[model samples]
Target chain A: MRVFITDTTLRKGMQSASLELTYEKRKELFFLLSSTGIHELEVGVPAHSEEERDYIKYLARSQHGDKVIVWNRANIRDVEASLECSVKKLEIAIPVSDFMIKEKLNKDRDYIVRLLKEIIPYVKSKKLYLSVGFEDVSRADREFVIKLLECIREEGADRVRLSDTVGVLNPLQTNELVKTASSFLDVEVHFHNDFGMATANSITAFLSGAKYINASLLGLGERCGITPLEEVVFYLQLIQGVHTGINVKRLYEIVNYFIDMTNIHLAPNKPLIGKNAFTNKSSIHIDGLTKSKRTYLPFDPEVVGSKAALAFGLYSEKANKLCKK
Target chain B: MRVFITDTTLRKGMQSASLELTYEKRKELFFLLSSTGIHELEVGVPAHSEEERDYIKYLARSQHGDKVIVWNRANIRDVEASLECSVKKLEIAIPVSDFMIKEKLNKDRDYIVRLLKEIIPYVKSKKLYLSVGFEDVSRADREFVIKLLECIREEGADRVRLSDTVGVLNPLQTNELVKTASSFLDVEVHFHNDFGMATANSITAFLSGAKYINASLLGLGERCGITPLEEVVFYLQLIQGVHTGINVKRLYEIVNYFIDMTNIHLAPNKPLIGKNAFTNKSSIHIDGLTKSKRTYLPFDPEVVGSKAALAFGLYSEKANKLCKK
Candidate 1:
């Protein structure tokens, strides 16, 4: 299945405490992401600041191949702000959970539904492709989520996204929610990694038939981040035969650029991209690998643009047992 | 299901390139693991060296609460070395994959099976409990794996472990394998995280009725390492209600001790134990949290011995609208 990726490295990635990407860094990463077969980019909210607004506008006018999608709140003012960027696509986020509606947004669900009814058509009139984002949908009532989607679909929204804002859902629950929501319309999944299952949940969401999954460079974003782009692409490609059109060779380059910007060291054990992911240390494993690398390798590390580093220790030496019986 | 954890911190964890836990460090971590409600400790292989053999013997004789299980190869010599440790239980690991048996052991599967026949009775005569470990079983032919298990089970083996030595299996495949193997016997899962699904695969193994899962103290070990003990226990406890008998309060402390000894920094975004796993941002999440934290959290961080650190950003200030709504 063709899995579309919306890499929000420039948008949400800036929210990470450890990252402060300069405008040049964001532009560099944006083009790097485009080079990695990423078709969509969630350029930051234009309303965040004048500089950000200018960057969004500049990105919209860039002669890049990526589809520049602007993010904004449910309010019409944010939509008005987005128009200034001249982006052809927009994502309007609204808090759908009762607690979030009351406590966070300080607006009832009815207020969001009413606002969407009023603003969606205006967005369509401007000819911007649109998707409505349900913020914190994991904690929202499923009935209410379905109801909201139905209304947004009726208003001619092209797609819907369920944001696991608190990163609470497991794979099973993610599957159920995505399955239910996709029944109403083609759905995207935006996940946070608070519980460390974001990548796993992303896999489950795809298994449940999610069309779009959000990932980021270095998984750089707010608290615990989203699924790492390299991980989802590699797992889906190697294990599931799903393709994200990512150039595996460029993954290390993209991550390196970001880590250079933030100086944040990626975890040594961070799945496909981590330092030790393909390091073989056990003597038996190394011995087996010298004869047939497949004997000790899950996949050729070069598939993800990495080489196997044989570690020095008890298992590093080729022992007598590895010889002919 | 009662999930058994065989913490191989000193055994397999020693194979990690980045770790060199001194004898003092090993002693400190071993006692700490025992305190974490962990019942089984695969201390080390007695065949490694005089120092390692002495350490294994020491751990076997220590007045510790954890059951010290010694590890050895399929050969009787390794088994003989394990007997010197005086451990009541042992794990005899044999390569079942054709490539490993041929390349690593320089022997055919038939020779390995014959060796098991010779060694099983010898191990039994020593009055030691035993579990035959299938090394690199993920890539092994299933029919052969099952056949070997049937033969070993007949020899009075207590259990068997399926090691995803190359870390190739995804969750679905993990479930199928564990399900198939557990139907034959009580199966423990030992996973390496080559593709970053080790934790997810471990979770799936549990869901598929696996009784024992392997973990390490620092998520440290050979190549991508085994599953992070903290991630597995935290996810299971909060999401699955499968308690590991661990004192939730001591998780951070336990991890810190290992990190301190190894001088390894936990990834800021590492799940459950990462710096930001419980960090909250976005004014909306903060607002919802003030009214009821559940609205913005999957589980209380305090449950994992962590507290929420509110991020200072766009939503850090409590706005007027939140109070009225």
Candidate 2:
């Protein structure tokens, strides 16, 4: 099945300390990301700042307006801010776990149900595609999560986002979570890479029937970041046979441009877009690549606008081969 | 169930072009890794160089000899080299995929079975714990892989390593592969991270009853590297309830030390050991941390000898809170 993507490079990515993009730069980023034909872009949190609101207003009225999704808190002010931007799609996030409800909001489950009762229909009345995001749902009581899903679905919410806010869910757990969440409403998954399982969990969530997968340009977000957009897209195309309409070849260019704009240097060994992702050093691996690219390379580097190279080093057998010749 | 780990930091890690650890540095890394109580260390490929052979001899005769496993190719010369090191344990790697067997080795399946028949008994006769590594097994024909497993088991091979040399298998496929392999002999899993799924695949392999999981520090290896040792160790302890007897607290320190010794700087968002793994900048997340750390953290950062901190940025609400106070 085809999967939809909601890349949050402009929202969750900007929330991290490392990246700080101005409105003009963010506008540039929007076009670059949009060029990939991503299904949606969580453009910005309208309530975050006047500049954020202005940017949301610009994107909400742009040619790609249908592809822009404004993020909001489960409050009237946040809703009003997005409404002012004339955004056609929005996600209202609320803490779902009991610990978060009590500590962060000083409320109970009844309060959440009441908040959803008001927010879900209010957004629906405005004819916006509303997604009720369950923040920290991975740690929420399973029965309560189901109850919340029913609550939102009953109130006309179009989707429910299973946010692994703390990055605690493994693939197996994600499968069960998505399976349960999808039975009620369209499912979107947002994961943190805290334990380095976000890519895996996102893929599992999709296989288990998640419709929308939330990711970022380079998995750039809170703490260890989120699922990487390039990873999910390439994986689906090459391995799962699920073709996302995204332009796979533009991935490296987009990620490189983002890195250049943000001055974030990825680890050379970072998967997919890293400098060394396709570079082979060992003689054994080089030999394998010499015979058949499939022997050492996962997918052709050209699929993502990259190329493979061999670096002669401590393990180079090229010298021996040349000597024999 | 307690899971087993065979870290290949000095072997596969060193094989990469970026890292060139001298024998002395490897000795230092050995002690650092050994202190974590890792089940085994694939120290190095003894047949690669004279220095490698000497280092293998030193480790094979040391106090941690039983914990060391020398790597070899599926050749008598490689086996004899390991024997000269007096290594009590060794793994003979042979290409198993049709493409690799045909192109890399210019041999067929029958040749593989023949090689295993001769080599398995030869290694077994030496009273060494032998693991038959099926390189590129992820792309091998399923029936042929099973047939080879039967051949190795009949020849008295103690373990079979399912090596995802091209990093193609996802978690579900890994589960099925490991489940099938474990029935014939003890199972070890080694995966590359080309698709950014090795950590997930390795964890799934363990959950599917594979006894041994191979990893490298920082996931360092060929191409985009292998499954990371830290990710697997932390994931099992915090998420899966599989307590590997590893000192989790030493993870950051060890990674930092390795980085200094190798001059490799990881992405700040690198999970577990990156500079920003526990740093929160977003106002909402910092507020959550203020109320309760669990609201924003996957696990206590101190578990990995790190601490959480708040950095004021574009999204900081701390300024408003302080003004109200």
Candidate 3:
């Protein structure tokens, strides 16, 4: 599977919970995730804190296996901070929609385009991989998004990340957007789970020709976090027949470690790594699942380093009783 | 604006982690939810236990305002049990796809039709409001769904429920399915949160043409639960201008009570009632939000008895300093 894992534990996951990590802790996490085979580490915005910038620089110098990506606004100051940290990849996030830009940034589409054109060359001068992020791209005018992609490509950006900033796009919209954007440039998908369409949207983007996806461990990020890495990895490899290059056996270990380090509880219903993702409760479902897993399961739980659990409650007899039989 | 609330706490919420309520507890919850202005309540399956049958019958007799719905399989035995329990509304659930019917039931399409035709009349004979649930309808062939809807409608089913049984639908698919089904009959949507598309799918279903939706408190159910009642209520009222006789200000109380009673930890990122749903984590976001609540919030959190939270981590200094401010 040609898969890429982006660890958002430092960014989105921490924001989702009540916990806060120091600069040293973030550096530790970046090193750990990089060593654990994650392809990308979304280190927090370098402009946000001098300490964070120093930590990103430390990790960039120390960790050699994975790309260190620093998130920033479409501003020269943010771009310069990221470059000073020696990060290989910089994500310049510019809100594309009139609603977001007008309301959030008090800027118009013309200003957005100008901002991207200005930042792209500055990052390229530092020899950093530039991934232009179109914030709230789903709500953005389709023509605007297409134009943004073209401008980013023309400006020599390595890739463009289509962000469903508010998590509004469904799979069909995701497919349409990604397909249109992919025609002009290498597309990446960054989905939030606000309305819980993140993973599905990401998969649809992949199917529509996006080469990279922005995901957090356990779908962690602001709001509902980003698309879950584990879920996207599973779907890409098992269902869509895509190559994600994920070490499936180590997925659970990574989840547990992140959970332990962050103290954020995974939603029981979270796909792949959630407590009950593979658990069967109904007697009928358990019976069929036990007879043959395909009767109830979409993908083998073992493929993601999870075991099917048959728990007893309102729906079925005790799993131990079934085992005894 | 016209809206309705259907609480599936008994049917779907029971599927949450380690949640097993006695017959009396279910009845108590029914009364509590009914008193809180829920228009409908999905009581447990009468086919499961004699106590369930007695409790459902008692609740149906006593709870005069709320529509008491008993969930059942499209089988003679299940329908008979629902009738015996005195449920006024019968939700007859049946597999609609060739994959589900053949793999799960080991039955052909002809057999399923025969079974539904046989049971629908018996259900209608009791003067019960019948809603046929097409399980996994998203994966089912559209032609098959249309045929089954026609058959059930002719047999006196009051409405049709399109179930995304495995939560495999995206918003586009949900809109398409609901729109297609609406062309034939009044449609209700029952979405699972399996792939994290439940809320978006529910919204799209509402936008497309669905009049009713199945929801559980806190989005609790087997594999990620159904669409969350709070989210649907909020979105319909705030965004879509639809009113659901729900006392929106009391939503948090009901959600918290259910969570505490069940001992299930609510994910901070859960929509509507989640801790982070109204939180502003980014500093820039906080600045815009302070300028105008509309800058960051899609809808007022107070509409659902929630206040915006300012949390810290990756996004901004203003968000981190909200508590201090």
**What is the C-alpha local distance difference test score of candidate 2?**
0.87
A194-248 in candidate 2: lDDT tens per residue? 8888998999999899999999989989888999998999899877789788888
Model 2 residue B250 lDDT score: 76
Question: Highest lDDT among the candidates is held by which one?
Answer: 2
Query: Residue B146 CA error for candidate 3 (Å)?
Result: 4.8
Q: Which candidate do you rate higher for DockQ, 2 or 3? A: 2
Considering only chain B, report the TM-score of model 2. 0.96
Q: Considering only N, C-alpha and C atoms within 3 Å, which residue pairs clash in candidate 1?
A: A282-A315, A283-A315, B283-B315
Q: Model 2, residue A174: what's the lDDT?
A: 86
True contacts kept of 1: 0.52
lDDT by residue (B162-259, candidate 2, tens digit) is 99998888887888999999999999999999888899898889988898999999999888899999999988887777978888877668878888
Shift of residue A239 alpha carbon in model 1, Å: 4.4
Best model number under TM-score? 2
lDDT head-to-head 2 vs 3, winner: 2
Rank the candidate models, highest TM-score first.
2, 1, 3
State the local distance difference test value for candidate 3: 0.75
lDDT of 3 by residue, B1-325 (tens): 4545677888777766556897777877787788767788887888988877877888878835247888898888888888787667889888888887887788899998898899888888888888888887877888888889888888888889888877767665676788888888888889877666677677767767888878988787776566888777766666556778877677668777877777776677776656777776777767777766655566666766667766665666676576676
List where candidate 2 sits over 4 angstroms from the true fold: A319-325, B319-325
